[model samples]
Target: MSNIIEIKNITKEFKVLNRREGLKGSLKDLFSRDYKIVRAVDNISMNITQGEIVGYLGPNGAGKSTTIKMMTGILEPTSGEILVDGCIPYKNRTRNAQNIGVVFGQRTQLWWALPLVESFKILKDIYGVTDKDYKDMLELYQSLVDIEPLLHKPVRQMSLGQRTLSDILAAFLHNPKIVFLDEPTIGLDVSMKAKIRTLIHALNKEKNTTVILTTHDMGDVDALCRRIVIIDKGKMLYDNDIEHLKGFFGYYRTLKIRVSGSLSETAEKIAAEFPEFSVSANDEWISVLVDEAKSTVMDVLSQLQKTYKIRDMQLEEISTEEVIKKIYEEGVK
Candidate 1:
């Protein structure tokens, strides 16, 4: 497959004024030469193949937003190169806008007072979609989502999930080659998240639209992304499929145990016993994050049994959420 988005050694820096407190200081700060250059995105490179749904994972302040803005023509990179469908996003802003769509959470492109259908018509005209193409787009949406009931509802009147769905629909109304969705399911319930995930998957398969999703919701990553890119401290850390990423810490495991004693005391004892592993306790269970390189699961279990009786225990592989957490705290070696 051809690469739809190519970013090479891209870097973005912002000049922020160090404003001093109080009006006297604030006035002088306006003319103050003191400024700090914050490198929001370091030298990072990735090529996204056409029709791929990539989860751009990162903690806040990790440059995910800056990277996306550069890709969408909203912000220019300070250094390096980016090409979205063969056009430099910052240099050819107008042309770039035509080839891509974006939906930021809580930011509706649809008119607040206008019906959803009216919004679709407005977007169709804005994108210069032909009559046949507009009709075809609606057909595609219908096949994937039940958009009829939402057609007459005004954007302001829709619920959170409904409005989010509408925003995504509006973004895809013109059938752009690529779509960027930021926190699309941030605050949605499980049912709506599932619905939106299904809608996005169906649309991607049917329309072959390349998707770039940035979200903290693990469920979104698990459902929509075959590939994921992880970044931290303004630098790219890991880029691969979920299964492949898991291999980085394959020896990692989570052991949950129920003991016939105080959870906190049990937790403290376990922590002291294996200072290398992470140990925590809730109301009913004492959970430990074990790195087998430091100690095997059986070795940790036997040591735990020496102190307190193990009532119930379950050992499981590290989860996607835990993997992400680990990567954020300590980047993959």
Candidate 2:
């Protein structure tokens, strides 16, 4: 597939008024303006292909939102270029809108007083969707979302999950080539989040819809996105497949093993032999940090099984969220 979105050395800068102290500063600001320039998005670039789900991530005040706004044509960039399906979004917003969809979880595009179906009707008109196409799209989404019953309900009366799902459905109603979902599952229950993730995956898999998802939820990234672009302080930190990101810190994995026979005796011997590994035991569970570079989990487990009866074991790799947090706190060297 070809590149559906291309961002080349993009930057967005804002000028904020500098004010003095208290009422004096407030009143002086009306007559004279002293402004400071802030770079919300520094020079950053990435390419996304068709039928790909890319996670655009960053901490608060990072350039993630500014980049999204530029891509969706909501804000013009300070410099560089952005092409969505070969058209500059800010330059050809109306034409570009026809080929793309957007869903902001914290905000709603649907009319508050209007029934869900009515809002869709307005969108259908705005997009110039054909009767056959609209019906077919609704049918496809209904199978994935089970939103048929909520079609006639007022958007204001619906729960957050219902409204978010409705927003997702509306985004894909026109069968756009690309969709931008910003925090689509925020503030949702576990079940509802799963449902929404399923819906998003189905849209990308069944219809080949390209997706750009910006979220703090690692689960959403894990479930739907294979490739991710992480940014901080308006700069790109990492852009690669999920596995590659994980591999950056894949040298160690935490192992929690439950041993039934002679807990204290087994723990003492295990710790004695593998003093190089950080080993500890508490409540019949042996916790060890297995260094993948030096020793494997299988090697550790095999040694333990021979010494004691090992009932069960659970291995956990460093979570994606934790890795991202580390990058945000300390520069990814």
Candidate 3:
């Protein structure tokens, strides 16, 4: 399959002004600014194929947002290239916007006072949709999202869940080939988040739309994306299948045990022994971190049981969230 999006050696930099202590210093900075160039997005490259849903992840100020902004034509790159459907996003923004849709979680593209249907109608006109295409697109989304009841309600009056559903529908109304969703499930309840995930999956399967999802929610990543690209401090850390990413860091496992009393000493000893694993404790409950490659969960539990009375025990595979956390914490050195 052809790549729907290609980013090559992309970098973005911003001039940050240094300001000294007080109100007087703030005023001085306005006229005589001492600027430091901050690299918001360092040299990065990735190719996203058609009909694929990619999870883009990073901590705060990790340049995930800066990369997305550059891809969507909201910000021009300081250097390098971004191509969406074979057109340069920054240089040919109008042409690029016609083929792509973007949703920033903190912002809404729909009109607040208008009803959901009205907002979609405005978008349909904006994109110059034909009557037949408009009807088919609306029907397809209404069935996929089940937004019939929410459509008549004004956007401001609807709940967050309702508005989010409507907003996603609005983005797809133009039948864009690719969509960029930034925190699409942010601030949603568990049920609502599930619903959105289902809708996204259905959209990809039925319409073959390429999706680039940027989210802090690991649940979203686990549910929706087969491939994930991780970024930190403006650098691309890893880009591969989810399973491969987990195996690459093979330093995670969960150890749960019930021991006599608090077992604080044992917990402290275990933590001290394995500095790589983080440890936690509760009354009569001791949990130790186990690196699968270093020590199996069974081995750790058996050793602990010999040292202390163990009533109950369980082992869990490390979660994607924990793996990502370890990667960032350890700096992939």
lDDT of 1 by residue, 63-140 (tens): 999899999999999999999999899889999999998998778778999999998888888889999999998888
Q: Which lDDT tens digits does candidate 3 get at residues 154-194?
A: 98988888777777888878888999999999999999999
What does candidate 2's lDDT look like per residue over 237-284, in tens digits?
A: 999998888767557787889988777777777788888777778877
C-alpha TM-scores of all predictions: 0.95, 0.84, 0.95
Best by lDDT: 1
Q: Give the TM-score comparing model 1 with the true structure, all chains together.
A: 0.95
Report RMSD (Å) for each prediction in the order shown.
Answer: 1.6, 4.4, 1.7
lDDT of each: 0.91, 0.89, 0.86
Higher-lDDT candidate of 1 and 2: 1
Model 1 clash pairs are: none
Counting only residues 3 or more apart in sequence or on different chains, how many pairs clash (N, Cα, C under 3 Å) in candidate 2? Answer: 0
User: How many clashes in each candidate?
Assistant: 0, 0, 0
lDDT value, residue 251 of candidate 1: 75
* Alpha-carbon shift of residue 253 in model 2 (angstroms): 1.2
Pairs of colliding residues, candidate 3: none
